[model samples]
Target: MHLFSAVPRGVLTLLFASLLLSLADAHSYFIVTSPTQGTQLQNGAANRITWIKGLLDDIDAFDVEMSRLSVDGLILVARDVPAGSGSFNLFLQDVPSADDYYLLFLNSTSGVMFTTSSRFSIGDSSSNATATEPDSSAPTVTISGGPNPLNDFATTFPPSANGVAMPGWKAIEGSKGQLIGLFTAMMLCMAGGAFTLL
Candidate 1:
């Protein structure tokens, strides 16, 4: 009457152990401390490249390097922080001659996951570059008879909240014309089936 009764007791024990290992290995989340993405900083500003790492159960320590990709390999290494410190800090002074540079965390034994987020800049002027954000103010419009409205919004607006297909795409989603068209199409299909049967 038990659910895993047909399985061998040893096999069940092994499965439970495997599940525990996977849970430990699969836990990680990183967040930048300061000078957020696409932020403009002083020429010699030693911005602390600190990041909050979530779930540090497995990984004790790892090296963090601020690097930029080159034609051959990582070229501009502003800072390379070695492991083994109670508290760790990464700092960068001179802005790389290059444009896009990112932080790379390398932990072979434990937590080596790196951030693939868009490159942040350190420059004199950030007037032209705008920080990307989602539009959270608008009250979304919904089609009562169709699929969910939030899904429709996501399919239309991107994460940057830029370049929607049409300004009225959300507002006009529940318009009578659209509903009538869908209703009419369904009725016509039903009628065609009835005529064939007759």
Candidate 2:
């Protein structure tokens, strides 16, 4: 019997399954820890952003995108946060001017989505918020991953291998691009073996 024909069907099945798992999409459970939703933050006051695991499985390194937008949709501040593991504490410095509301977004490397929490203007005065001291018990917002499989979340780019917190982004549906890539690889592998048999 030829070597290719002699190969068991179960062996081929196992190989396919392995490939599926490797290409299987991964997700993260992101949540906001500090500054509960709907809470008011004073201008120029330092507020800490709290988040759970922010890394997506396919992400190579940790990177965070922070943005502060005005009520008129003006961008006040935007930058990258250094990547790390587990729980993360992010600082909001140089707060926006005369802004009624602002949103914070976070993402993880292995995560397929981005989580967000918003804080509205606290007062009308132009006084600056004290730096360094963050109100620990100021009604922290808690974010968690959904138990349902069809989790709809927005994903951030340049995934952090061990990112703790990411900026706020809306959830989106799974990517067709990734699924198509997996199937194409399977077909190529199968064709290679068939040509050898001939």
Which candidate tops TM-score?
1
Tens-digit per-residue lDDT, 106-152, candidate 1: 54235555543346654532334433322243222111111222322
- Candidate 1 stretches with Cα past 4 Å from truth are 4-18, 26-36, 54-58, 70-94, 107-118, 125-198
Instruction: For candidate 1, give the lDDT of residue 171.
Output: 43
If scored against the real structure, what TM-score would every candidate get? Answer: 0.38, 0.36
Cα shift from native, residue 31, model 1 (Å): 4.8
Q: What shift in Å separates residue 125 of candidate 1 from its native position after superposition?
A: 7.7
TM-score: model 1 vs. ground truth: 0.38
- Candidate 2 is scored at a TM of 0.36
Q: Put down candidate 2 lDDT per residue, 1-198, tens digits, no spaces.
A: 555566566676667667665655445445555456455554434455555543553323333333345333223122233333322332333433433444444333344335555554443225554333455543222222212234322222233334444444322223344556667677857865674556
